[model samples]
Each structure stands twice: as C-alpha cells, then as structure tokens.
Target: MPTILTVPGYQNSGPGHWQSLWEASLGGVKRVEMSSWEHPVKAAWVEALDEAIADCQEPPILVGHSLGCLAIVHWAEGHDREIRGALLAAPSDVERPDALAVLRPFGPIPRLRLAFPAIVAASSDDPFLSPARARILAADWGARFVDLGPCGHLNQASGHGPWPRGEALLSDLR
Candidate 1:
C-alpha cells in the first residue's frame, strides 16, 4: 500500500474531518505536523512538510486540503522528490485577503507544473477558492481536475464525513 500523507490546512483538520478520519482508518497514513496550526508560516510549513516526507520509508502520496494544497505546491516547486501523486482538495486561495489574515502570507501561489502526478478535486460552492480558479490551478499544475458540485470546502462543515470518492481518487493515484 502507498503511504498517504495528509497535509491539513489552516487550523488543522478536526476529528470529524475527512483527513483525520482517513488517518484513523488507513494504513501508512500520516499527518504532516506543522509548527503552528493556528498560526502558519509558509516557510515553516514547507520545511515541516519536507521533514514529514523524509520520515516516510517510501515515497508517499500527498493529500492536502485548503492551505495544505498550497504548501504541497510550494514544496514541489523547490524539491524533486519521487512520490506517487497529490490529491488536492478544496485548495484555499491565500491570495484572497477577505477570508483569514493568517492565510495572506502564502499568497502568489506557484503556477509551475508539478514534477509528479497530481489530481485536484474541487467543489463548486467552496468559499475559499472559486471553481474556475481551482480548474485553472489544476491546469497550471498539469493535474487532472474533478468538479464536485456544491460540496462546500470539502471539509467537516461540507458534510464529507467519509469521503469515499476521495478515497477512490487516492486509490487511482496509488
């Protein structure tokens, strides 16, 4: 089985979130621990992510949500580690200043194509990032894009208690 590294967004995924649930249920699933969950520094996050990947015995598949997706992109932009793929869900727009003040620093997201394979799954009703922008991001990264209609943020509040489709997507990457 492929190592599934879950990279959670700002404030971190809570107990009820899909990422957390996957960690509990799946084997070889690990959560990337950021230095600070409530207060995120882009450099810190990127470094932490690198450390997490290094800890893995094999190249691990990255599963990022919201800001975590941006972290994976930034990490990939600088490093060329051999991994399975990335599953980017509800990628939050750090460029947008309206949401949270902490998310502003990770702005000016990298548009470079990822070295490894990746799949971007976005929701139509995600307030963090618009569907159009998500598609563009996927295109820029040269990853397959999936439009999941009206699933807000694809998080705990979005009601994805057990995201089976996301699991299937991860399986494809594996």
Candidate 2:
C-alpha cells in the first residue's frame, strides 16, 4: 500500500487534532515533520515535503492542512514526483490578514496542476478559505472538491477529533 503522509499546519497538529488521531488509527500513515513549526519558511517546508516524498518506499498520498497544504502546492510548482494522490483539508487563505503571521509569505496562491489525483476537502463555514476559494483551488489543482458542511476549520476546535468522514473520503481516493 502507498504511504499516507499527513502534513499539519502551523504550530503542528496536537494530540486531539484529527490528523493526529488518524495517524494513530491508520496503519500506513506518517507525519511529515517540519524543521520549525513556530516560524515556517516556505523554502524549508517545500524542501521537507520533497524529502518526505523521496523517502517513501511507494508513491505517497499527501494529506495536508492549512499551511501544510500550501507547502504541498508550492512543492508541486517545481517538482513532479511519485505522488499517488493528495487530500487537502482546510487550506488557509494566506491572502487573509488574520491568518498566522508566518503564513503571510505564502500569499497570492501559486498556480499548480497536480500530476496525480487529489481531493480538497473544505468546510462550508471554515474561517480560513471560503468555499468558493476552495473550489478554485480544487479546479486549479485538478482535484475534486468536497464541501464538509458547517465544519469550522475542520479542526479540534470544530469538534472533529476523529473525522471518520474524512477518512472515508481518503479511502475513496485510493
């Protein structure tokens, strides 16, 4: 089976975060460890993602949130690797001023078309990227867009600790 690499946003996904729970439950899931979660540098994060994909024994299915999703897109702009698929969740709108200070550098989303299949899951009520913006991203990346209704940020704060529905969506991609 291909590896599922879970990439968390800034500050990293904590214990109760759905990504962490999914990693614990899923057999072939691994967390892509970034150099610094406090202060994210785009180049560093992109490099780390490249390294993660390179290290995978099989083609990897990327699963990312917020800044992590941006990192994946940024990496895709430069390199096309052995990526089987991707699952992007709750991508932050770097264009928004209220987003984390570290995320500002990633403004004006990059233009990309993923070589492999991908799905972008966006919450209808997410504070970051609006549903329309998420749809645009999915279109640009040639990924399927899924609207997770009323799910705020789709994080622990949104009360989604397990996120079984997301897992099911990911399974469909496989």
Worst 10 residues of 1 by lDDT: 93-102
List ranges where model 2 is wrong by over 4 Å. none
User: Candidate 1: which stretches are off by over 4 Å?
Assistant: none
TM-score (C-alpha) between model 1 and the true structure: 0.97
Per-residue lDDT for 1-174 in model 1, tens only? Answer: 778999999999999899999999988899999999999999999999999888878889999999999999999988877888999999998887686888988988999999889999999989999989999999999999999899899988878879999999999898
Best by TM-score: 1
* Residue 146 in candidate 2, Cα distance off native in Å: 0.3
lDDT of 1 at 159: 87
Tens-digit lDDT string for candidate 2 (59-138): 99999998899999988888888788889999988987687777898766786788988899999999888899899989
Q: What are the per-model numbers of colliding residue pairs?
A: 0, 0
List lDDT for all candidates, in order: 0.92, 0.89
RMSD, candidate 2, Å: 1.0
Per-residue lDDT, model 1, residue 107, is: 80
